[model samples]
Target chain A: MSLTKEQCFDQLLRSHDVKPEGKSAGWLEQIRVEALASAGALNFPSAKQDDWRFTDLSSLFQHAFYPVDSIASVKLADIEKFLIPDAIRLVFIDGCYAAGLSDLKRAGSGVTVTSLAERLGDLRVEENFGRHAPYKQDAFVALNTNFFEDGAWVHVSGEIAAPIHILHVATCRDAPSAIYPRCLVVIEPFSRATVVEDYAGLNDGIYFSNAVTEVVMKDHAQLQHVRVQREEKNAFHVGHGSVKLGTGSVYAATSLAFGARVSRHTLHVIQNGEGAEMHLDGLALIAGRQIADTHTLIDHAAPRGRSVQLHKCIADGAAHAIFSGKIIVHVGAVGTDSVQSSRNLLLSDKAHIDTQPQLEIFNDDVSCKHGAAIGQIDLDALFFLKSRGLTEERARNLLTHAFAAEIIAKIPVLSLVESLGRTILDRISGVRT
Target chain B: MINKESRILLEVKNLKAEVAGVEILKGVDLTIRAGEVHAIMGINGSGKSTFSKVLAGHPDYTVTGGSATFEGRDLFALAAEERARAGLFLAFQYPVEIPGVSNSALLRLAYNTLQLDRGLEELDPLEFDDLVQEKIKVVEMNPSFLGRSVNEGFSGGEKKRNEILQMAVLEPKLAILDETDSGLDIDALRIVAKGVNSLLSSDNAVVMVTHYQRLLNYIVPDYVHVMDGGRIVRTGGKELALELEARGYDWLRAAA
Candidate 1:
């Protein structure tokens, strides 16, 4: 018999014991209980649901994934290729902090970087742990909240000289397992920093990674957050990220999705103060039977705020890509300016893309625009390239790489751009690098 | 300046082609030889562009009948890039705009591929940069254009100049310029024509597909063929362009 959703939920609940520690144990235990209750009340999203219509999760629910409590065997040398030499690294193996593999001393003064499991007693952790990501609405968020063991915690008071790299490495043993990776970032006023969250797996297996990340940008703070998901081909990954911007704060985010059998990302941003600026960009390059979905929401509550979003998808083989973006301007939010565009390139006839761009405005003074385009590589462009001595396949690959470079160029970190470019090219060319 | 001693470069006999199951090139017979320039002129819908595309092996056009040979080798047997590597170049009427690909990179790739085909030394980036800079002077192009994407957001005249720049870099044995003077001011047309004239040599041949006789005034074609209903109806010397300009293509169509 197939495992029922309720049975799966019960199994998850019984798999791990709650071992709360430090001064914030009571608060943490209360949060976990409330999240579990929420999870119990809400069922897994069905295909009938409008938000889950295109992406079916029946296959994901059939897998009996246990919570990985013990540390799985992983070599630091194997993950050394993904490390940035100039940045501080925080390594997580199967949702638990790997202190032996991390470089904690690289953080300079005015910055605090540590694992959330170790700093449970910190007051800041209690204040901002579940503030942005509401668990009641999303079952995945609730599951992550109820089951997350440890994640990276970063606090920046002033401009940090180097970026912070958080690596989530998933390794499976004999049985299929699940990992809930959580991250919390708080940037104080008048500071600037860049954080990169990279998720990768060592082997191919049927696993689940439910992740939640929350970021808080104080007044006049500037932050660039980058998330890269390159998991095993048979794994399932669902992530939710929320960001809150203060007065005059600047927040920019870019997410690159390249792996997994089925991957979905939800990003929410709220401009809480006046004159805040937000920029969101994403790219998904998937082939084979994989599916990648990206959903984003930006709320402009303050006046004179500006936001720009550009999302692109390149799907080949029988792959599918979905992008839905919503921008809301409150009644009092006048003089708001926003632009959203989603462009997709389908390399094969079997590939598919669905794009929905929405804008809700209560004020007439706002300037908002949205557009979506789905097309194959232009035949004329391909012919033009071929006439210049390039093979048809090489020309198509070049155009596909160019389509993705538009979003990859928006990355703020200069060093990351080249490597990301190479990775995207390799993905398009079917190279194993 | 036709020399009998020169070798035949391309020979097309009774070529017929169609696009979307509609016949466009009924029968286009033409002969091009080294050390000569041929201009194919006709009214709109006269299959001028289709004939050029057919010779370059465009996927949209299917050659229904007849054959074309270049240097005694079957031209129809080769793919588009293979045709290009075999020293056949076509300057498009409407150059495609490919965003995010630098013009210099495209040019260098074409140059290196042709160099490899010809067993010549391929230039590296540093060497190719100097060579491209020297070639840009052929069309009086700005050096900054090399940094921009291939024809993305380029002006009409700039796109034409870039095409000539490619031709200059590749140095093809046979080049067909389709309506190169379509959307150009007099100064831009003169610059483009001058670039083509400078690239011409006794070992190479040029075929100009044009609507106006103004371009012929600069390049000075050795043979001008007027095409109508997909066939070359009239063949004459350079003065035929002057007469055709004086009395438009309607006169030739009516005479044919």
Candidate 2:
């Protein structure tokens, strides 16, 4: 007999039912119970859905993943390579906080960088948790809201010079496990900070990471965020990001996706107050039967809002990359200026890309422009480089590197930029097409 | 500087080429010696640019039948970049812009590749910067141009000047300038011409393919060949350019 949608979700939640749970705050427990009911009510999105048309989740659903109940051994040396120097770190393993591996003492006054399990009673967490990220329509967000136990909680009231690194490492396990990595960042009025949310895996083992990040920017707050996901090659990654901008606030984000068998990131940004600005840049470099999908929505709800977005995908070796961007201007949001461009590079004959940019403007005084381009390397440009004595291979490599460097140059971190540049160069050197 | 003992730099005999199965160059012949400059004047669709592209091995044009010898070697045997490393340069009529690649990076890479081919030491960034700083003066370019993307957002005159700047850096043995002065103003034309003249030496030669005699006035050619109907109909001294400018290509077209 074919199992119903609720029955399938029961298999996913069966393990959580057997585990002993700690007593949470009254409001937080109410949220988890409501979210569990929502998860059971929401059907799993299939290829029939518009957003899941290009991305298939059948492979991910074949395994009934159990939430990790036990702490897996992870050493500091294992995660040292992913650490950024002089930055405050809060590390998590298998969705559980690792206190020994994390450094939290360096955070200054009026700043709190700790785990959500510890800050359950904090007013900031109580106010913003499960509020910014919507779970009614998104099944993955509902699943995360139901199962997530611990995550990074950062609140900045004053200027913080050092970037905060929220590192999540998924350890290899024999049983198919599900890991929920959550992050909540709140920047108070006129405060500024930078944060890096990095997700990586320990070994090439099968696991599932359902992550959610919610960012709240107050009036005149400025934040620079960089999200990097390089999961194990055999893992499934689904991430959701929801951001709300206040009056005169600015949010600049750079998202990079490099690894995972099949991964999808859905980011939604809303400019709720006047004169807010948003910059969203993304790059997805995938190959070898991999699929990377990015769906973004930017809403200008107030007057005089501005946004600029550039998203690029490089697909090779039968890989598929998808980008769908939508911009909305509310009826009263006049004087909104937005530009979005989606560029793709297919390095092999079998590689594929699907890009769409849509703009919905309700006001006549707004300015919006968007374009999408997908093709191989320009032959004339290749010949020009060759005529300058560059070998054909070197010429192709240089052109591909330059195509990716346009977005990579905007990243605020210096060491990450250099390392990512090297990664791109190394990948392009082996590309034959 | 033309002398009888100067080595033959390029020899094209009865060359034929076509693009997309349509013949554009039918049995064209030309010859150039070291320390010599030759200008080929033609009207539109006269196969002058085709000859330059065919020699550069552009993928679009296929050689139906041709024989080209550069420095006593079969030029067709080498790839486009191999031909470049062997000292054959083709300055495009319309220089292509490469976005996101800096100007100095391309110049340095091209210079180092040729240096490696010639068994010379390659210069690092500092040394290459010193060399490029000296070469930028040839076209009177601002040092800031090296930091921008190659040829991106450059004016017509600046593009032409950049082509000559590349020519100066490569110092090719046989440099073919294809309509290098087409969109240049009088001032840019003089600067480009002067840059080319400064690169000329006893061991190198140049072939300028143009429609007007304006560029020839700045750096006079040793010989001028008037081409019509895909073949050279007349050859003369530098005065032939003046004659073509004065009488136009109608006379050559009628004869061919």
Best by DockQ: 1
**Model 1 stretches astray by more than 4 angstroms:** A1-6, A17-24, A104-106, B119-122
The sequence of per-residue lDDT tens digits that candidate 1 reaches over residues B152-183 is 99999999999999999999999999999999
Evaluated on CA atoms against the true complex, candidate 2 attains a DockQ of 0.77
Docking class of 2: medium
DockQ of 1: 0.79
Q: Which ten residues in a row have the lowest lDDT in candidate 2 chain A?
A: A1-10
Q: Which candidate has the top score in TM-score?
A: 1
Writing each residue's lDDT as its tens digit, candidate 2 over A1-433 gives 3345455567776756855585378888888888877877776787888888988676677666777878888889999878888788999997788999998777899889998988899887999999989877788898888788789999999999888989999996887778999999999999999899999999998888999999999999999999988888889899999999999999999998888888999999999989999999999988888899999999999999999999999998899999999999999999999999999999899999999899999989999999999989889989988888999999988999899888888888887888777877877786311
Against the native complex, each candidate's DockQ, computed on alpha carbons, is: 0.79, 0.77
For B198-237, candidate 2 gives per-residue lDDT tens digits of 9999899999999999999998999998877787888899
List clashing residue pairs in candidate 1: none
